[model samples]
Target: MAVAQPKIDLAESLLSRHAAPGPGARWAQEARAAAAARLRAMGAPVRRDEYWKYTDPARLTAAELAPAAPLEPEKEALYGDRAQLKLVFVDGVLDADASDALALDGLTVEPLARALATDIHWARDLYGVLEARGQDPVPRPLAALNTAVAGQGVAIRVSARVATPVTIVNRQRAADSDVVLHHLILLEDGAEMTLLEAGPAGARYNTCLEVDLGRGAQFHHVRTQGRDNERHAITHSFARLAAEASFKAFTLTVNGVLTRNESVIEFTGDDAKAHVAGAAAGDGRFHHDDTVFVTHDGVNCESRQVFKKVLRNGALGVFQGKILVRPGAQQTDGYQISQALLLDEDSQFLAKPELEIYADDVACSHGSTVGAIDEDAMFYLTSRGVSKPDAQDMLVLAFLDEAIQEIEDDALADGMRERLAGWLARRR
Candidate 1:
């Protein structure tokens, strides 16, 4: 069926026009041009779009960027690990002088701009390939816009085991900053690495990360969006896994006015395993949403998704997730669950979980739930001399711990626990 004429007109009116790629490698420029064309054909975000019907899309499509005050540098880092290599971005501009050298055994990390300057590079083939492949089932126009005019990011190619994990740190120092970045991650056969990201790029930002996993590769990603009260953000992650590849990713979002994160994953080869999970907390006019799609096209692949949210004082949370099993994809194992704890009657949690299977022998299941904090547990803790607020905090931690345990690394899980505990402490 053809899209109505009014839909095209609305998309054109709401879509922001980004600047063209300048003097980059021929391949990058050509790719950007193609992406821009696709964005135009797709149109802008409208209420008619089923994927965005619950959330308002006007702010995302607005032409002007929002103003976000720079947050004071924290004396104690959120992650509290100084040994890891830190790639810093200030106001959306990559800071090369202050960052750790882009050198690691079996990995090549280059600035997107620099990669575009070279005559030939593997990034040329992956810059926007996986993102385009994820357009089906739903069209992500904001992601397409990021691809068309992403000015700063990194391209990482990993071919062997890396001894150290790399963290991407984004810092916003200026108000009304418009930040656009796209990162390409390519893992060769038998490669392994851990990728971490944190911070708010700008008041309004569009960020995209595309991951391509070769046979037998292993990749892990853990990210913290930010604690900025005035910030609004929309981000997307697209990943493709090959045979025997393993991918695990988790995100923590706290204290943003509005945040919508979309994740798309596809298993193209048999025997691959993937896990995606997130934990979010919001209060006082906060709104958070996570939309995810996992596709299984190969036999014997496995996938799991776990999400938890805490809301209070009229705050809102949303989760829309789906797992798809294609024809001939036998022995697929998929599981998904999303839950929320509401501290007050005014708060709300919206969830939609789905499973689509063509093969009769596969096992796929999903569940979603929203409920108030466990009063019995809260009373049990309060009876032990804990204050009401402190008891509530403990219960909230216990509720979210299930999702945090999804991280296999002990240190990483410890870091997540500390951050969540700190946030809860402040609120109490």
Candidate 2:
């Protein structure tokens, strides 16, 4: 009998096909090669992997690409009225022709390909360094693959406070496109910025973003992932914070065929703070997952995680979050909560929340809940002359409002609220 290939070996085999080296400078080439080697050593995630047990990895790791049509989202503009700088990308390649001026007054934007050149840049040092550091305690083969084969992306550096938000808009056009993009962002000491993003890139894509915040720096990110429900994506955001630095990120996901967003953060300086929140909605045949890991190594640091998801029509939602407090992390305050609303009997939600603390004195807590909609509230709304569909939607949006309100900026928060309302309108 011919021996069947082991699942681990098969997984590695599939990743190898996507590992062919791309053109770049010697340093960039070497970095990619090293990352690819690490990915092979770690092997691709399979159903056997504990972290991937809830969702099948076969769809994401298959050797052949899936066919997908480009999406036009004229009606899905979330921040259309905002007067912020804009950068455009098509199929993961920076569309210079479509983007505004590359050089702003206080910041510089350049293609990530420059890191491959002989001239040394901060990006060259950070290209895959943060992702490599995050591999410990958990192996991320996808992140490693991105470092090794990412074809195009952008490099942004901020030295002063940016009054205008910078938006990265993605547009996909081609069937069966496979896009790998790696983004690098550096915020110097005392710098601040707000990043706005909206779009669905392609049928299949892998994206890795690395952000390094210097002492006393601040970074705010708000994103919407509602358009083009057919896209499948795997994304990783790795962030490192210095003393007194702040990082806040919020994501609003509409329905999608498959999506897994992972965020990993580490506090290396004392008094640093980080907050992450997400609100997602799904219909039948949709699958969305959020996996987050936050580590507190600095004394007096604080972190928070709040996630809310709504699923109906047999859709599936997943959340896996953890907070780790190192030995020296006394006076640390960490909180986490994950909750879901199942609108129908067929809808499903799966969540895993954790806390690992080695510190002697620290306050850390986590909570998870899954339940159906409240009939009493529904009855009250309907009795007030509100139709059932509208009443249910109002309740659903109210459930998501808590997470959305976390955005500090009033304008940004209002924009997100409008998007949520539009989403409910479409569902109606």
Candidate 3:
């Protein structure tokens, strides 16, 4: 249950010798120092740790990591053309000129650095919110590492009875560098919002996003990871919902050498709802993992999760999901499913689903399936005048469309479908 002391000592020594907290590291003034101490105390997680048995982080060394830097003026154009409200962070440093704030009513968006200087109470309360509640051991090093050196991110609040969408685009373009830490937080109350996050890399990227929803609030988050072949990227998302609130998150990954998308969601208020869904297409030696943890802590809360993956070439796909219902969470309704399609014998898929419940009144179930292309279905399609490659691609798309079709946004779904289709063509 604990990492070895020698590893902790070594990590601490290396971190102390090479890493220093960034300028204006918010949440806690000495957060990096505090995290370094915590890492020293907790050490790194290993395979023996049940939570980390599947994915290992010990292979990642300090030498493999590098601090993020500021973005250039010319590169700012990439974000401006894609997003309406853009906040750019280069190597963990906020670029004020690259971001143009919107003066929309009932919506507030500002950089975490600025907010920390002005609103210390909110910043302090937000710091370590996720760290204090984590149960896994694998992320101990990552959480501590990110907490210690997280640079400028964002904090946005949508007022009561309001509806607004906030889009965040993160770009990592370091051709020869280390790792970049990106943090983002979104809070809404009786409001509706959308967060569009894009990570394209030529570097290593680790991003942590925290979202809090108040009563009756509705939030939609779409994340896209399309980094270069050599880039390594990981995203950690933590979300909590209040009474009658609805939280929906969608993720699509088509790139990255090694990418992991981890999400932890909690329904803490009665009648709260959450839907977590993702689709990934991997090829050309890419390794992608999607992990989701959902907890029902309040009576009458509900949650649903669906993940689909398509792997080709020598690519690998993994999905690990768990749903827990507490003793007091009566009438909790939770469902989870993960399915993967292997395009070739060299391609691979791993799906694991778990359910732990202490409530007798709760209804929880989980399912997973891993298989190759259905030859009968493909032949049926080919007989209907469909080309061999096109038929196979169509069947793959149809299998994954069940999850994507549940999305409420038509334009977003269409765009994601197009991207998946293009990737399938390349696979063929």
TM-score of each: 0.96, 0.95, 0.89
Those runs of model 1 whose alpha carbons end farther than 4 Å from true positions after fitting are 1-16, 75-77
Ranking by lDDT: 1, 2, 3
For each candidate, the alpha-carbon lDDT, in order, equals 0.85, 0.84, 0.70
For all the candidates, what are their Cα RMSDs to the real structure? 1.7, 2.5, 3.5
Error of 1 at 362 (Å): 0.7
Residues 1-428 of candidate 1 have per-residue lDDT tens digits of 66667656655554445555567888888887778777778876676788887777777777665677778768213566546778898878899997999988889998988887677999887888888888887888878778888868999999998757889988888877777888889999989888988988877888999999999999999999767777788889999999999999999888888899999999999999999999999988888889999999999999999999999989899898999999998999999999999999999998989899999889998899998988888788888999998888888888898889988888988898889898989887
The candidate that wins on TM-score is 1
Give the poorly placed runs of model 2, Cα more than 4 Å off: 1-16, 19-22, 76-78
* lDDT at residue 423 of model 1 (Cα atoms): 91
lDDT of 3 by residue, 267-299 (tens): 889999999998888887678888889988899
Report clash pairs, candidate 1.
11-44
Q: What is the descending TM-score order? A: 1, 2, 3
lDDT of 1: 0.85
Error of 2 at 71 (Å): 1.1
How many residue pairs clash per model? 1, 0, 6
Which residue pairs in candidate 2 have backbone atoms (N, alpha carbon, C) closer than 3 angstroms, thus clashing?
A: none
Q: Please name the candidate that would achieve the greatest lDDT relative to the true structure.
A: 1
Candidate 1, after superposition: displacement of residue 125 in Å? Answer: 2.1
